[model samples]
Target: MTQQLDFSVGMGKETTYGSPSAVTRFFESEAKAKYDVKTIKGSGLRPTKGVARTSRQSISGFEGSTDIELDAPTRGLGFLLNAVMGAVTNTLVSTGLYQQVHTLSTTDPVASYAIQEALPPIGGGASNVHTFRGCVFDSLEISAKEGAYLSVKLSATILKMLTTGATAASYPSDDTLFSFVHGSIQVGGSLTEPGATTLAVGDAIPAVNISDFSLKVARNLDKKGWNLGGAGLRSRPPVLGKPEITGKITAEYTDNVLRDAYLAQTPLVLILTFTSGSNVLQIAMPAIKLKGEVPTSNGGDVITQSIDFEAFDNGTASQPIFIVYRTADTTP
Candidate 1:
């Protein structure tokens, strides 16, 4: 009998674009990754009949997406972060501790991965493994609600797919998942250097009641760089275009700080941190402008404000988003 628990997702970094990489790590995901092929149909008029010909249809390319329950695994989370941010710096902090700082890359040829999804074998049949090559994240969303663990959704552009040579799935033993109780948000800080600025403990916003938050970073890749002779696949990797960073925060409407900032068009810094034991994940947006709506009442319920914000470079040389992960893992 087939079982949903038997499905697995594995990934590894690719040294070369569109090249297959060995499955080095597995993820505890919410569902199986999906890969869909793009196709094109010839529009030629056939004098033979009124029905369209099936031979005119052809494959063009592939795209995929997956959702993972975000966890602080010793060595695998950085792979997803690098796919989104394009760059990472890993440093050993102390004994059995390391810090990984992920930043946006300004150059081409960002990191790519070979992702494998293993379907549960049919009754007494071998498992089917679908490997997606040259997988680059086009967008990544990290979200956290009131009573759930942090989740990550990745939309990827795939160059090719293979369905053979299944690799056994293996998970890390030191995985620690972060929940909403382990999260905190700080807002309304000033950035001295805008994109390059780091927030200190004193920069924390005081007495802010937040219910939920989400951040989405998109690397709007140009996926139309196909050539005539490339056999229905991308001739080269998708060209990275400008990055778009946006987010939303739902918080209790207790003060006029956020409303006043929205009215005055103030530039604010927002920091979100999640901690579980010695593992910590911090996302810092150095400069952002709020587009907030006033809180309204509904049947005597507590009023809440939903604020939409966008991150920008703030005229600095550095990238707008910075993610720092402190964990015991040594490598990404």
Candidate 2:
């Protein structure tokens, strides 16, 4: 029997934490589910043997990751956004058009998901399905460059992995991808909550030319929250620590706006918008401080500035980071 590389990934929100949910949406992705096992060995000193004897190994827990092409899917990406951001307010903006405003939740008990990975069958053999339950995002990264599509990398901590009773993968047909051609950046914008209203056009930076950008958000979950009597699995959901939002932007060194802000320790707002037909995704950093160096010339090429930034709570906004996604999906 010859093995093939055919695989599929699907996910759905769990009604109860750690309970398996039916896969409702699929992703075009390179995804995997990993198991973490603990090995135990005898520590007693042997009289004649030189090597220690091995005892046993057992499953501890599970984790997984998915690298996805960021698409303007009407419904699918909302699950991921909610998993990371903790809360979302979805509303219908126009006829058949919906807007989802994702924000950080101050309350405990965020959303959890069940992810299924369907492995290819060996010739006529039965395909294996691995389902990861109580899946929560440990970290998420969104990045894009000129002439490239937006990409997302998600790291998740899973409570358990079940290999049985999972449905086959099926994907939606209405998803559209977001590329760099559909992207725009605005720096030093007015800090405004992206609710029903969009950002004003006059808030854009004067003449900055951005080539590439990347943003990363980490949940910093405490993975050792396991109890002694409940087996090696987590007794409760992993405790979330302070979130860290950081990113980098590469742009043509046309002016000193970014450098001057960094040198003077000034705070600024960063907004990135992407449009795919009628769908829109807008990411806003209400307060950010630049930490990158000034642009330096190298060889005869166009000078560029790669600026590092950190997002912070502006004390008035809903959260340190906000995302407004407009699509046709009515439900989150």
Candidate 3:
């Protein structure tokens, strides 16, 4: 019989980029671990050799990236989103027994540390566990479909990877999990329309004929220190490049509202809500500048319109994109 090798993973925010840590938070979902050993080739003529010879390649750098598919929830998903956006929550407002997710900012972001491992043996054994430090979110893709569970895919870049011989004995539990059954979309705000600046709760977009929707957030980060120093990987964090927000929507061609917005360069408001009983998660973009052309096709099933849009800031610090969730966590 083959030996069972059960794995466990944990993550935590790091104080400094490229610094290792024993992550404390555990995620109970599908996770894939990845690591790369960058090397520099030395294929040139030697001093004593007549013909060109090759020498032992030197270890140039170490980097890691991971993709995790998580169920959309209030706690872990909120935490991951805040980390990616480089935002920290400063307030939590609650009424009755529900705690409302306050304004999440993207002013200053920090890296989150993670560990990919397995449950250690009783006393002593070779443990195949790796700890990563200074991890930053590279991209996040969220998808939802009718009669399907809402899920989120998170991609991250890490600085250093340390493979320890043995790991801690136990692991944490992922207890609070939320699905996508209670998802809702509130649309009806005008883009570039006069007297329509903010969106209210009553402007709920009907989802009776909607098929699927997706939202992608990317932090176009530039990985530096690739050719720095002589030996070992560098200990500096990556520089954040231009942040981007893009998404696609698949819905029935109900009207020419979105098409009109795309043509007139209108700025629209979108509020995506996910709720599981009392727990709720909201992704609100106040000023989403429309881009690309609206494509339509007549199929045998139904008439659907698919268009792409990009989120942009309308010269405001705190009004571009807002990620609100219902949790006890005041800060992420």
Candidate 4:
């Protein structure tokens, strides 16, 4: 007999941040469900150590945290990105027309969601399904190559964990590939773009050879734990700390334009888009400034510049980091 393999994974958009769901509705709409899942790795129950006078080893306390790794996706990745950045979408209904826009504004508080995965049994028992509750997006890194599909690596923090017999069995629909061929990188002095919302598909930096680019967002999360003479498991919500956003870009150095931008502290806008006929998906970061080390040299086959930048508030909601997804279906 062959062994059972673990493959199915599902997630839900939480109505309330850090609130666990009933597990009854584990999947989202088939059309909007995130399907380009590359990998799911998690940390089981970890214990904090305490020293005592009698024992040689330290004492074990309540479970610390369950950190999970969700590999990045090209298609349908914005849904998960919204959860971590506390980004939200707004639907404007006009005369027989509905427009959906996703935004990650400075004033917006980050949101949370629930994630679960099915694993194979270890010793010929029933399949085990684990659910992570109160899960918050901690950090994310997106890597994009010239011709390859954009890869995303995501990290999330959870408050609690639950295991049960595997029953939910289904996968979401396939996704259209998103790659650097359908992306754009622009550097300017200000966050203001003349026609940002209506940017055409061919609007990108000209004569610049871009090899790769990356973006990282971090929400400094802290957990509270105090001794109160307790017997049962004590759980508290993970507190959000000062958040951070940073990114890097590797490109062929053609001119002194990037160096000039760094010296004058200029802003940059990154727009990655995927389109097939009338369907479109995009991730836009309208306000970002270079704060890291300036590119000197990559010492590679070609003269390349590897520069890092930090995301900043542009003092306007329209200029903030956002994701715009257009499909026939409304829900995501």
lDDT of 2: 0.76
lDDT, each prediction: 0.76, 0.76, 0.62, 0.54
lDDT of 4 at 258: 74
Q: Give per-residue CA lDDT, model 3, range 50-69, as digits (tens).
A: 65334556666777788877
Better of 1 and 3 by lDDT: 1
Off by over 4 Å in 4: 1-4, 13-76, 90-100, 105-110, 122-126, 165-167, 189-207, 225-234, 292-300, 316-319
**What TM-score would each prediction reach against the true structure?**
0.89, 0.91, 0.80, 0.71
Q: Tens-digit lDDT track for model 1 on 108-224? A: 876778888878765645557888888877888889898988877777767778887578888777677878888888887654332222322426554458898999999998867
Cα error, candidate 4, residue 68 (Å):
6.0
lDDT of 2 by residue, 8-42 (tens): 78888888878868788777775566766654555
lDDT-wise, the better of 1 and 4 is 1
Worst 10 residues of 4 by lDDT: 29-38
The all-Cα superposition gives candidate 4 an RMSD in Å to the true structure of 8.0
87: Cα error in model 3, Å: 1.2
Candidate 4's error at 76, in angstroms? Answer: 4.4
Q: After superposition, how far is residue 212 of candidate 1 from its true place, in Å?
A: 0.7
Tens-place lDDT digits, model 4, residues 1-332: 11355434566656675465543223222111122112223333335633332333333333323333333332345566665666555453333222345554344344656676665566555555676665666676667777776666666655455665344655335445556666655554333332323432324454356677877777666655424652222344455676777888776778777777788887766665555444455556766777544556555666777888887777673545655655443344
Lowest lDDT 10-residue stretch of candidate 2: 55-64
Worst 10 residues of 3 by lDDT: 191-200
